[model samples]
Target: MSSAVISISNQKGGTGKTTLTMNLAAGLARRGRTLVVDADPQGSALQWAGLSSDEKPFPVSVIAVADNLGREVGRFAEDYQYVLIDCPPTLETEVTRAAMRIADTVLIPTLPSPVDLWASLRLANAIEEVKLRNPRLAAYILVNQLEPRSALSQGMKQALEEFDIPALNSHLRRRAIYRNAALEGLSVYCMGKRGEPAAAEIDAIIEEVL
Candidate 1:
């Protein structure tokens, strides 16, 4: 199979893009080859990998390339079955466009809120822009930091439906464990194969994206 490149992107900050990217990387890595490219200028994903001067290495390798992701990713894609790009929260950046240009699919993470929904549209438009150049590009929106049964989540879901965007049924719920796991360079799925709420959601994403 040609390596499937999935970019976890959002034009707004704190949308859990990196969280989803990292966890999905871990989940897929267990099954087969996976590589994560941190295309964010902030290097948050790199920091999360916990590479220090003393050790100078990490379980997952992350490179700082906020400018030329397509070139960097092209070089890395030969060795991996899947390449996951953790993008910055800006569409105007070249890295985001480069990622979108090369991606087989783009996973846009949005919170179930009006503000997030608005931001999601902007990201969606950017994806569309990339699609114009690469007509075969596939993209989907995944809800993150969501609270089920709340009026806001319901309203946002309804709003998303009004638009033509395909939103994934599986969502990442608001939980403290997500925060805790990032500190250890681990995904919630690593907590266990059983009784792990996040694993189901991550699996759902894999099913939909694949």
Candidate 2:
């Protein structure tokens, strides 16, 4: 099968883009070969990879190119079954656009809040623009950092219905394990008992995407 390039992106910062990118890459790596391309200059994904010893689960490459990110990622498409790109937050950056242009799917991770949902409209617009160049590009919004008991969470889902992009049914609940795992450069999959729920959620996303 050909490689599927999925770009985990959001124009807003602190939207859990990097976190989702890392975990999703890990989840897919367990089933098949996966490569994560860190297109963000912040290097959070790169840092996560650095924490791994000689037995790194998967390889992560940092490629912060503003002009030809699609071309850069394409070079590895033939080798791996999946290529996940961790894109920068700013929509004004060319790298984000380039990544979207080449991505078969773009996963937008947004916090379930009024401010975050409002800020994500710009990214929704950017996706529309990228669709012009990449007619087959499929984009979906993933509700992240969700507080299930909060009224805002329900409201956010209802509000997202009016947006152009569709939000996935599978969501990530607000959990401390996510934070703990990131500190150790490990996915929730490696956290044993505490990470089971988080790992399940990531698995659901992978199942839906594939």
Candidate 3:
């Protein structure tokens, strides 16, 4: 398959950008060769993979590159079936824009809160600009940290409707296994039966977006 570049971007910190990037990379790696580009200056992706032991390393290859990130990602795309770029949490930076321009699709993880929705507006503006140049760029919102038994607040749902980009039907819920897998430098897929539900959530995301 020709390389498909997916960029995960968010303007707000603590939006689980790195977590989604890493787990998504793991899912994609299972399907084909996948590379996770740690374009975020924080280097979270790299650090996550670094935690892996040599005996059982991270499932997908990961590397950090801030300089000429778009160009470097293009190079990697030629080799891997999927190249997932983990952009910085802030959208104003050129680094984030660079990744957005080159991506085939962009997934923005958002919390189910009014504050987070406001934060996403700025990102929506950035995406509008990026889409101008790259018309094919498809963007979606993947609701993160969604409470399992809680219903979506009507106000928040109304706010979500204000955005032009549609939110994915699949969402990542608040679960302990996600953190558990991370502590071991592993994706939920490796957590055995304990990871099944979380892994299933990731798999649903894969079905919708990947």
Candidate 4:
């Protein structure tokens, strides 16, 4: 079977979208071929891959197409077993629409807050609009930066359910390790090669997605 193309997106920024995309791509790469498309103008994911420097951890080829990404994405499908598009924050961008239009699945990452939930709903609507162009697109939300043992996290989970968006049972908790790993141009999947919480979380997300 061909690999699934999943776009990690959100309307509002600073929701750990790039962070999750890179880590998840690395996690899935352990099992099969994976390519990451850095469709965001910020190029954070590409930078995180250490592409800004002369050296990179591995050849994670990232296409720096921010404007006309839809056309570029079609070309990406033939190259890898999985193509994970890390979209720009705003859904208004054509790159975001392109990723949504071709994605086999769209993973929206959101914080556990009312404002974030509202933004997520808007993102879901946008994904639906793109689905009109490609009826096979499947979409869902994954709760990010969740603080375990907190009331806010509990409330947000309930609100997401009420919104009727299917959420992954595995929620990513707020942790500094994620940031630290990014700086090293390494993902938790690689950082935890010796065994760590970050690695375990990444593995869980991969299992859920698969």
Predicted model with the maximum lDDT: 3
* Backbone clashes in model 4: 0
Ranked by lDDT, the better of candidates 1 and 3 is 3
Q: What's the candidate order when arranged by decreasing lDDT?
A: 3, 2, 1, 4
State each model's C-alpha RMSD to the native.
Answer: 2.6, 1.7, 1.4, 2.2
Cα deviation of 196, candidate 2, in Å: 0.4
Pairs that collide in candidate 4 are none
Evaluation by TM-score, superior candidate among 2 and 3: 3
- The residue-by-residue lDDT of candidate 1 on 1-210, one tens digit each, is 557888888888899999998889877887778888988878888888772343433345566775667777888777888889999998776777788899998888898887788867777777778899977788888889888878998898888887657888888898777787787666776565432888788888888778
Write the residue-wise lDDT of candidate 3 on 1-210 in tens digits. Answer: 568999999989988898899998998898999999998888888988988888879999898887888778877766899999988888667987888899999999998887887888888898899899999899999888888566664455677778778989888888898898788898988889998888888889999985
Which runs in model 1 stand beyond 4 Å of their true positions? 51-59, 193-195
lDDT of 2 by residue, 1-210 (tens): 668999998989999998999899889988878888888888888888777667644344434444577677777778888888898889877877788898999999999997898898898888889898899999999999999999999899788999889988898998999898888778889889999999999999999988
Judge candidate 2 at residue 63 and give its lDDT.
46
Q: Assess candidate 2 and give its TM-score to the true structure.
A: 0.94
Q: Global lDDT of each model?
A: 0.80, 0.85, 0.86, 0.80
Per-model TM-score, in order, reads: 0.91, 0.94, 0.95, 0.91
Model 1 C-alpha RMSD to native: 2.6
